[model samples]
Target: MSSLKHSHLYSYHAANSRLASFAGYDMPLWYKGISNEHMAVRTAAGLFDVSHMGRFSIKGRDANSFIDHMIPTNLVKVADGGAAYSVLCDDNAGIMDDILVYRFSSDDFIIVVNAANIDKDYGWFKQHLDGYQATMIDETQSIALLALQGPKAKAIIQSLTAEDVGNIKRFTHRRVALSGVDALISRTGYTGEDGFEIFVPDCHVSRPLQAEKVWSQILSDFATWGVLPCGLGARDTLRLEAGLCLYGQDIDGSTNPFEANLAWLVHMDKGDFVGRKALMELKDHETRKRIGISMEVGGIPRHGCEVLVKSEYVGRVTSGSFSPLLRKGIAMGYVAERYTGEGTAVEVSIRGKEWPATVKNPPFYDPKLYGWKRVA
Candidate 1:
């Protein structure tokens, strides 16, 4: 709305991408084109400048206590160099922001949050830190993140660092040097395809030139692998195809982890947490379910479209798009619990008409042919 904040690679993006204002930051929507970038990530590889997301460093004597108090997951089991997808919840167990927690040790950790929730999440984090001996530093500006995703993601990083890229298993991270600058490489991505999220941080007070160098080197060195610089448009499509939830759309302030079908991330037996009491009550009391649907015989469903069954309103579409990979309209939305069963008949209202659709568990693209599980 006002002057937009810029990432370190803003200049590069300005020259190469079609820029748009997203989350109060000037970000790329497409480079060559949405379809071109989307297909590249599904087949070969795609690089994304995700520096707009919030990055935080948490460290101190009570770091574990502070974090474990906020999340329902048992942080005790998260080994050093391990990471897990978790959420920040309100007292009522309502979703505030879904986040990724990376554990380096008992007292050192990294938390990555969505771009739009930076200030809100940070303020909440500080309030919760009052009793704990730890400190939370907002490193969103200091760190530059590049998500190199697709089948060939590992090979590109392997060529840069001496570390065994294969050893960094999924949900694990390691310190590696690339383009002569140190970085933290994590084997996690939004795309269902196997890939890595590389974090490049500035050493001195000045802005990080190393971040730009690393970004350049990956594109120049791996031209043969067909690595294209992607934008948020492709990122959204790939994540939806992977069946992953976007914070604001798929899950929001009113959504709980269980209702969003993220029960696996909640550790009820892990002892007390901020929302543990409320979540325990919500466990089996869920009246709504987050369902993925596919449209074979209608126009592309958009957010806010009404979901119906037999002409009765059931819910609304949260995130929807024409799947670039599956070649059909796919979406994720919440509905009355009874209507969420797999293969259940549903219809989405677009404009004034209802389009025939069905509730299907996502990775809307077939797993046997696409995704990390499929043989490349």
Candidate 2:
């Protein structure tokens, strides 16, 4: 069997002219193309096959305590059924990976990590768990994941399942039934929109599901929803607009939460955790800061491009894109503290050309996306 093949949703995406290739699995690039698909989630609704995302379930007597010590967020604050964004950090406080930790019970938790970081993350967990009594299992291959996003997302998903999804608060999850399939429906998404991530077992094949079947059925069911299949391009633009960080781009081993503008996810109040001392030291000592920038001049900025203050090189662009809503090139990067305010004049070097830019607060679009309000 070829290692690279289309996802279960492959034929559905192909019918819509979606570009596809191996992405952990054969995945769609765009169905109606990038522009149209991006606009759909911005204005109405869109569905995504996020089955490629990796999930690990940790369970044992020491699971909760063990995981809390591994990440930089205050896991104690995560209520049962709620999720918290966290960073797995090294001893020096450098990020290993950014992930979502779901506290399902005192002894059970599910961690969702990036697809590319799955093996590495699991390895770290295995090594660290040896001293503790917790058992960590890689459940990535067994679950199908889908994200339904946009202002209409709730309404469309509610019609398919009778799980009282309306009562589920943001970052919280509930067990629901979708077209007779039981699922773990989470009110979470990467698009920065009001959305749900449905985790169904791959074996819900008209019988008790074994988790693996839940993942496959999601990709196989796109035809029933009339959803415009989305690809990585749309995923990037959507997250950028929402001011969410992309791991490899916005954050990495060398990037700290403070420099990535993700310090909110780091809880200094939480008693000693991994990288706590370093993160605390960074907080007390003033240094560089991360900020969002919007180009006044008409042009697209790209990763690794230079951000200049006058004639001096201050920093480099981490992520940039043409804002469909703002109608301008927008970017995020690290700049000196003095140049970190909105309206501060800056320049971005793009392909040997300097483009006029300004420091602005993210997200580039209306902040309403975070509020889940319908765009007018």
Candidate 3:
């Protein structure tokens, strides 16, 4: 078997965690417990070492052009300090990878991609960047990223960063100082909560500013504020509960942007892109579509489980898990476009038995909490 890789924060997890091999990294699945970690973030605050996520920096005179050709988003209009959810597509409009594009300036931008798709996305960027005066840098190793998420995220994060975290609008970013450490703070996250994803230099160990400095400060400030350490397990469930899609599961090479209910990410009016022709044709009508479903049955649905409509195979669950917050199984997947609707009764086949399922409005949790909010 291949040896497991380690993140820059590996030592920290080793000190306190139930480490597991996930996406080839010896990552922490949970430290305390999934429930405890989940509750910690829901009611209080949680810190996550998301360094396993891919970070790519694209810079040049033609950086915008290069990205425009590669992604379906309108890259030119992305104001400095603003961000947008974007996805890479193939010649056929199939999703190559869904990424978060954080624009720092007109010519400088950072993309956060799934950990497993780092090499795949980097390769696609390299091959498709022809003629653009762009330089793509994979800085995954040079950065140690941390996600501070929860109800009290702002109070905890603002205590360390000089830049106003409260003023940073949703889906925007800025360079700021965190406990004297120069960092990039973005009002963004995967979990459905108010949070900041801070980026720190990996090589800088001296706490004139360091990871520990920011960590300790955030912890101390949030002690009464209710902040704790969360792991990948809680992260997964939280995102799932928020009705977010995972790269390999809910979306992949076979899933087109239109079919994945990600049409908002596709900008057909943006002149032309990699899969413009194919995507434009399907823009008016898509045969299959993605939807969120919450199970009312006793059994929990899992990924790859068969989905049935009237006892006939219709689709399969892509991302599924028991939501601790909701006390039921929730999932997202693709099905015949005709079957995508609220209250559409369905069935999920798990193990050897079939269980009842139904389509529900996404974000099993409160929708208002999913967006950014000011601390009261």
**Residue-pair clashes per candidate:** 0, 11, 0
Residue ranges of candidate 2 with Cα displaced over 4 Å: 5-25, 202-227, 369-376
Whose lDDT is higher: candidate 2's or candidate 3's? 3
Candidate that scores best on lDDT: 1
TM-score-based ranking, best first?
Answer: 1, 3, 2
Which prediction has more favorable lDDT, 1 or 2? Answer: 1
Q: Give residue 286's error in model 3 in angstroms.
A: 2.1
User: For model 1, what is the C-alpha lDDT against the true structure?
Assistant: 0.90
Candidate 3 to truth, TM: 0.94
- Per-model TM-score on C-alpha atoms: 0.97, 0.90, 0.94
Tens digits of per-residue lDDT for model 3, 188-292? 998888788988865322222366567667766677766778899999998888778899999999988888888988888889888899898879688878888
Q: Whole-model lDDT, candidate 2?
A: 0.77
* C-alpha lDDT of all candidate models, in order: 0.90, 0.77, 0.83
Question: lDDT of model 2 at residue 247?
Answer: 82
User: Residue 265 CA error for candidate 1 (Å)?
Assistant: 1.3
- Over the stretch 1-376, how does candidate 1's per-residue lDDT look in tens digits? 4599887788889899999999999999999998889999988999999999999999999988899888888887789999988998899999999999999998999999999999999999998888789999999888888899998898888989887889999999999987678999999999898899999877321475888888899888887789999999999999998889999999988999999999888999988888898898899999998999999686899999999999999999999999888788999999999999999999999899889999999878778777788766
What ranges in model 1 sit over 4 Å off? 203-206
**Which model, 1 or 3, shows the larger lDDT?**
1
After superposition on all C-alphas, the RMSD of every candidate to the true structure, in Å, is 1.4, 3.4, 2.3
Question: Any idea what lDDT model 3 has?
Answer: 0.83
